[model samples]
Target chain A: MADRNEILGAAQGAFNADPAASMAAVAEAAGISRATLHRHFDSREALLVELGTRSLDQWAGRLDEVDAEALAASGDAPAIRAALETLVLGYVDDADGFGFALTDHVILANADLEERTQVLADREAVLFAAAQRVGVLRPDLPPRWFGHAIYGLLVSGREAVRIGDVARRDVGRLVLSSLLTGIAQPQNQDSTP
Target chain B: MADRNEILGAAQGAFNADPAASMAAVAEAAGISRATLHRHFDSREALLVELGTRSLDQWAGRLDEVDAEALAASGDAPAIRAALETLVLGYVDDADGFGFALTDHVILANADLEERTQVLADREAVLFAAAQRVGVLRPDLPPRWFGHAIYGLLVSGREAVRIGDVARRDVGRLVLSSLLTGIAQPQNQDSTP
Candidate 1:
C-alpha cells in the first residue's frame, strides 16, 4: 500500500513510453516482482482502471483549481478566457504524463470510467455553455463537441512535441490558439513576411 | 497468400475495436487459427507493420486522387481550401477504418514505417506551405504542425461519431471547420439565438 503511488507512477511512465508494454515489463519498471504487482492489481485491466481513475481525479483537481463552478457561472468572457488558457497549459502536462490512461481502449471501455468521464464532460459542458454565452467560445457547435475537440487537440499537440514538430514550450499556446481561433488566417491579417 | 488481405482487414478491425487484444483474439477475429496467423506474419509486431504500411498506401492513393502536387504548386487559396476539405472528408473514413494502424504504438515505433510516415508528412508540408502562401492557412505556425492538427482532428471526429457525440455526416464538416477557423466564435458573427 505504501509503495502503491510509486508503482502507479512508474507503471504510467512505462505505458506512456510503450503502450504495448506487458505486465512483466510493468512489474520490472515498477521495481517489483510479478507477484507483488499482481498483489496490487489482479490483472492488467485492474491496473489500467486504477490509472484511468487517477488521471480523471487529477483532471478534476485541475478544474477545481480554476474554480470551474464559478467560471461556469461567471458570464465574464475575459476571465473565462484566461482560465481556459490556464487549463490548457495545465492539461499539456497531464497529456504528457497521463497519455495512456486518457486514451487506452481498456480505460475507455470500462463502464465505470466512462460514467465518470461523462460527469467530467458534463461539468465542461456548463463551462463551455458559459463561454459561448459570453462570446468566449464559438456558438455554432454543441458544447459537447468543444470537449471532444480539446481532447483531440491536446493529444495532437503532445504528438507534435514528441515528433519534434513543435517545441514543448510552444504547444500550450499552439493548442489554445488553435482551439480559440483555429489555423486559418484572418482576412484583415496581412500575410507579408 | 490469397487470404492475406482478408486477414489484415480482420486484424485491423479487431485492433481498432480493442487495442489490447491478444494475438489469439486477433486470430479469432480473422477467422483463422493462431498457427495460421503466426505463419502469415510470424509475430504481432509484423502484422501491425503490414497494416500500417497498407494504411499509408491507402493514404497515398487518396492524396494522389486529389492531385496533391498540382494543388501544392497551384498557390490558389480557394482551390487549396477545397482540396483540404476533400482530404479531411476522405481521412475521416480512413480514421474510422484504419485507426489502430494510424496510432498503434508498435507501428509508430517501427523504423521503416516512421520513415514512410515522414515522407507522407513532407508531402503534406508542401501543400500546407502553398496554402499559407495563398493566405488559406495561417502563416504563424510551421506547415508540419498543420499535419499534426489534422491527424488529431480526424481521430477526434471519428471518436465523436463512434461515441454518438457527433453524427457521421457532420464529422467531416466539423473537423474541417475546427481545423480552418477553430471553435471560437467569430468576433463579427452574431451570437443572437
Candidate 2:
C-alpha cells in the first residue's frame, strides 16, 4: 500500500491534469484500488481537505524556516525584502506542487482551509507592515493587497513558464522585480537602453 | 423569445455563478425552455464557443476604442501609457461580466478561441514593444509577459472585489498603478507618506 504522502502526490498529479478526476481514478493513478483509497480517505471531499491542510502546513513550514516572523518584527526593510524573496522563490520553485491547492475552489472554499489561509495571511501581514514602515513597500495600498499581488504574480509566472514565454529559472527575478518596481522602467533606476 | 445575445448573457451569468451549471439550468435561468435554448445553441460547447467569441470581440472593441495601435505606432511614452490605462480600466469596470469567459478552461482550450487570443496578443505586442522602445515598459521582460501579468492581475482583482477585500470602483486604479509603477514606492516618485 502506498503511504499517505505518496497517495496525496498521485492525487495532486491526477487533479492537476484533470480538475474533476474522481477518487477511483486517483487511486488507479496511484496503482491502488478504490477500496484502498477509501481506506485512506473516506471521500473525495476528505481527500481535498487533507490536501488543503498539507499545503497550508508546507507554507507555514517555509515561513518558519525563513524565520519570517522575527525578520518582520525586526522592522528592517532589507531584511524583510530578503525574507519576501525567499518566500517568493520557494513558492516559484514549488509552483507545480503548490499551485493547485492555492487556487482550487474546493480547497479555497473549505472552512478549515479558509482559516488556515487567514493565519498565513496574518503572518505575511507582519512582513508587509514592516516593509511599509521601513519604506520598502508602498504605503498607499493596504497590506492585504500585497498578498493578492503576490498571488497574481505567481500565477502569472507559472502560466508564462508553462507556455514557454518565460524560462523557469528566471521566474524568481521577474516576479520579484515586477512586484517591487512594477513593469515600467523607472528613470532613476535606468542603467541601460 | 429571448434574443441570442440575451441567452448568451444569461448563460454567462449562470456559468459565472456555477461553472459546471447544466444547459437545462441555464435555460431555466434565462426563463426559457431547453428547446428554445437549443434552437439558438446546439449544445453547451456551442454556447461556450459563442461566449468566447463575444468576449474576444469585446476585448478587440476596447482596443479599437482606445486606438491602441495608433498610440503604439506613435512611439510616444505618455500616449502609449494612456492607451494602456484605458484598456486596463475598461476591463476592470467590466470585470464581473467578462471575468468568466477570460479564464474558462473550455474557452481557453478551443482552437478558435486560441487563434483569436493570439490575434489579440499580436496586436497588444505592438503596444508593448512601443512602450519598451520609449522606456515605459521594462525592456528586460518579454512583451508576452505583460499579457500574462495583466490576465493575472485582473483575475486577482476580481477575486478581491468578490471577497470584499477591494472596492469595485478601486480595482481600476489598483490594477493600473500596479501595472505601471508596481507596488513599491520608489524614492524618485515618493510623495507624502
lDDT of each: 0.85, 0.81
Interface RMSDs of the predictions, in order, are: 2.0, 2.8
Local accuracy of candidate 1 as per-residue lDDT tens digits, A1-193: 4399999998999998887689999999988899999989999999989999998998898889999889888787778888888887888888888976656778888999999999988888899899888887887887889888989898899789878999988888888888878888886777634
Which residues of candidate 1, in runs, are more than 4 Å off? Answer: A32-35, A188-193, B27-38, B190-193
Instruction: Tell me the TM-score of model 1.
Output: 0.91
For candidate 2, the per-residue lDDT at B74 reads 80
> DockQ numbers for every candidate?
0.62, 0.53
Give fnat for candidates 1, 2 and onward, in order.
Answer: 0.72, 0.61
Name the best candidate (by DockQ): 1
Ten-residue segment with the worst summed lDDT in candidate 2 chain B? Answer: B184-193
Q: Candidate 2: which pairs clash?
A: none
What lDDT tens digits, residue by residue, belong to model 1 across residues B132-191? 888888888888899989988877887777678998788888998898888887878766
